[model samples]
Target chain A: MSALLEVRDLTVRLRVGGSDREVITGTTLEIAEGEAMGLVGESGSGKSMTAKAIARLLPAGAGVEGSVHFAGTDVLALSGADLRRHRAKVAVVFQDPRAHINPVRRIEDFMTESLRTLEDVPRAQARTRAADALEEVGIDDPARRLRQFPHELSGGMLQRVMIATALLSRPLLLLADECTTALDVTTQAEVMAILDDLRRDRGLSMLFITHDLELAGAVCDRTSVMYAGQVVETSAADRLHADPLHPYSAALVQARPDVTSTAERLVAIPGRPVSAFEAPSGCRFAPRCPHALDSCRSTEQVLTGLDAGRVRCERAATLRGRLLDPTESPTESEETADA
Target chain B: MLRFLLRRGAMLVATLLVASFAVYGALDLAPGSPIAALTGGRTPSPEVLAELNARYHLDDPFLVRYWNWLTAAVTGDLGQSIPLRENVSTLIGQRIGVTASLVALTSLIIVVGGVGLGLLGALRKGPVDTGVVLVSTVSAAMPSFAAAVVLQFLFGVRLGWLPVLGTGTGFADSLKHLVLPALALAATSVALVTRVTRTAVREELDKEHVQTAVSRGLPWSSVVRRHVLRNAAIPITTVVGLTVASLIALSAVVETAFGLNGLGAYLVQAALNKDFAVVQGISLVLVVAFVVTNLLVDLAYALLDPRVALGSRAS
Candidate 1:
């Protein structure tokens, strides 16, 4: 299947506090039509930045060297009405529903705004559609909810409202930017189920951005793990979870506390995660990688294709099966193999 | 809503009563005697003094005199001004129109100029924002009396465009006469409202909802109006209310500078001459105006933000 959204060599530089800092550096990913792709990373890993770039919602004075193609249209080059249309076609759901909704406006107004203003739909008709959308998201008494302000609703309900509003534009791609991170676990599962069902029902493509690697693996068909603003690995979601190619991805998987296993301590990757602008010229993950060779500090790393996936690490073949084993260090494994 | 109104009304009455007592008691506590002002600083014969004391209740205790004055005040009798020898209420009634008109004009200018420039600064941001910040800062720092004199020199004397002295005869001429004074009165408040509005709007624009609004593909203008301005209205309204309420106090200087025969000017003259009755009456009226203006601003809050209104209802 042809990719519905393709982002190639996307680099974004933002002017923050009077200086230009690169936030996203040469990140590449693709989502096929009607397929859900997960972009998993820790905070400051450029997951949100990539979504904002696709939506054309970067802050003013931002410099973007990118080619974001959605439905075969170059998103970066679009301006005026075309940019607006692109925004409508690609919907984004942010993490905090309360902060992402206007407190003073009624939910009806928030949901119907795009229809009323952009499509020039009449008020009553737009309101009816909003009610219907609200109903689809499992909100009971949709008519009353339509009249209520955002503060009147709980966070989970407001998130559902946000999801309903996102669906109002009949968008081709839904960018879920840590949408469930702020909710309670139960609410998060419910919202995730709603989103998954709706995406399937509408044949919609989704770029689910989150810090939860397991949750992304559960929801998305394909997953891409990002570190320091670069996509380090892309493969089947379960495969990436089971046999991650990059050392950083392996560390992330191991760091997560597993309920099924009796691990005594959660394995933490040493050192703090660096932002894209602060990353070194060589492998961005080399500083913290346990298997880093001397060459890993000096040589440039690029995404190399292997076994139905891509990984940026130079020693992917040598370290393939040994990544998941926590007991054996790289040197010990090499010595044992030689013996 | 009715409960809220009733509670607010009771508070208003209590506040006014306390304010009136403070005004009445402060003048009573002053060193100079009302009798001295009444008698033109001359000593009267014993019989004459006794008669004057009987007429004015000068020998009554402080509480007795306050009760008598308060009772008569509630009945529209504010005693007679010693200097002007006129009924205090009648004098105030005549002068209230001019001050009211001046205040209304100044408020209009404040709302329009302040909100407009603020919105311009926030939305335009770079050079325009800098210019607004610079201008508003200078204006805010300037005293209204100094502004009054400068405005008088520029518009009234140098340009010979507007009349600087006295309240003019008719509506149109009166508006013309009041323009300079009103501008001077509004100068500091306009700057205040502008700074508040600009800050509120800029903050609202940065909110995530505003970003969501943009991402929804709504027109930029629509997003600003529906999301940014609506959310910013609370703070803007609060600052506007505070500044406008303060205009009453600041108007006294502007009125005296421009020589407008308004209540503010009358109050200043009455205070200087120790016309206690006139001062008391005007102070009561000014207090009422301030309280009523604040009450209106509170009502505006209920209208602008449903959270306040609905929260009250829910309680």
Candidate 2:
């Protein structure tokens, strides 16, 4: 009835070369019951780091501090049996299916083992459930597919298997980190559609992390734009596209190419993303923002907004009246915000 | 596969031919004649020495002598041992059973014990495991001869549980004498195999698939044997194959220690008495066994892992 997963004030730091390198800065977000949230950011924007933190899959060197509340359990406080029980509730579908499966194991055995292990189901029951899950993920001929090995299957098919294995647990939250980035365009679409259908059918919430803003907007109910390890803006998927308050989000939206529209050249962001160790003191995006005032350079902005959807921008006051209509179709004729 | 076998067979034949030449050359290089050795370095009359040399084909030029020996070898006639006054092949045939039994037992000890202890140490990863690895490393560091002497002192002289020497007693009793030698021979191999298995297993544990399994909440044991162990086996097979050559060489020491009438002992006796035929036969047998064992190991690698056969694309 309420939020399915809530992440609050999450920060993760690692000691690298005698310095405390913060990989994920203080960021807060939530996914409501049966609602999907897209977290869009470039490679070093801490999107994947945040997802791994939520799953408690960080390497040994990492130090995590935050409360990830999923299904009323404080994910950080849970330990031992409590932690394991909560982990079973939040499943992760990694990017590479080959690295995620037992190479020597047949697809059927691997799937059945995964299903049985997470749920404590009997072997025979697990096998039946695995086939059913594979079918749910739109794999044709589930029986034969199960018999095949990971090496024998295509990347898209393997990814679907990973998704099926994750879905078999009936998890409340699915953390998918660039799950289709390694596949071809056609395979990506097929896998995405399968995921979309599975999410709708199961009424599951997903934290879909990716670098593709268009794909995120197309699939997510809400989108959170992240920059250099902080959530810079959050709005309804359509609103974030039309009225991007944060300069970083605006740059991201501006960078996307439109096949149906016309632009002399796609405007790319000026610089590569700053490394986690070199994150700026003030607003991390301020250096790149053309609208940055003296205050934007001197002081860090806090995430503040009247609605749950917020933007960490000091220029929010000036930008509020200029916001575009969320329902406006993505056409070049729409208001350019011209900032 | 057929092409591979054909190439291997050709190479094996060439290697044997080269090896035969080396053995013949060594015999030809010996300082004194067999006639002199038999006559205790006496000045044998020219007619008598010439008659003996002609009988043994020493009168022919080196190439002709070698060619005659080669053709004679093909027909299982390796001339005769002057000192023993016996057919060279019959002497070898009589002695080969003892040598083969010794080599076979030693090989069994190495392959079985080494792999078993290695798997154990890798899995346990405790003090006991550490102890096994430590002992193996130390044993591997020592030469087989050194290990043989130490084992002989402990088991043969002090323990008095087994026979002391010379393939003593009945077949079972002779086997009992071989046990200590075999154990000594296997000691290093066990250490090596265990280390290999442990390293391979530990590395496999860190693989992403292993983490994926853990994330699924599968029991650790199932993850290891079903996934990690099988993948770890590829490298271990390579090491095992390479070790066979050493294992065969180490058998020489074990055979000598027990005074068994094996190839190593026969070769030594033949060399001392200037019995060229016995020396040649022993060398040929050793080289053939070494090459054949290597070939078998390579074949096993192909069988145990399809990736090696399929050019790693299957991986």
The best candidate by DockQ is 1
- Worst lDDT run of 10 residues, candidate 2 chain A, spans A326-335
In terms of TM-score, how similar is model 1 to the real structure? 0.95
> What would the per-residue lDDT of candidate 2 be over residues A184-277, giving only the tens digit for each residue?
9999999999998888898999999999988899889999988888998988897777778777887788688878889888877776788555
- lDDT score for residue B188 of model 2: 72
Off by over 4 Å in 2: A17-20, A72-74, A77-90, A102-105, A115-149, A168-171, A321-339, B1-82, B85-141, B145-203, B254-262, B310-315
DockQ, computed on Cα atoms, for candidate 1: 0.74
- Candidate 1 local Cα displacement, residue B103, angstroms: 0.8
Clashing pairs in model 2?
B114-B190, B118-B194
Model 1 chain A: ten consecutive residues of lowest lDDT = A330-339
Evaluated with lDDT, which candidate comes out highest?
A: 1
lDDT of the structure predicted as candidate 1: 0.91
- Segments in model 1 whose C-alpha atoms lie over 4 Å from true places: A325-329, A332-339, B82-85, B309-315
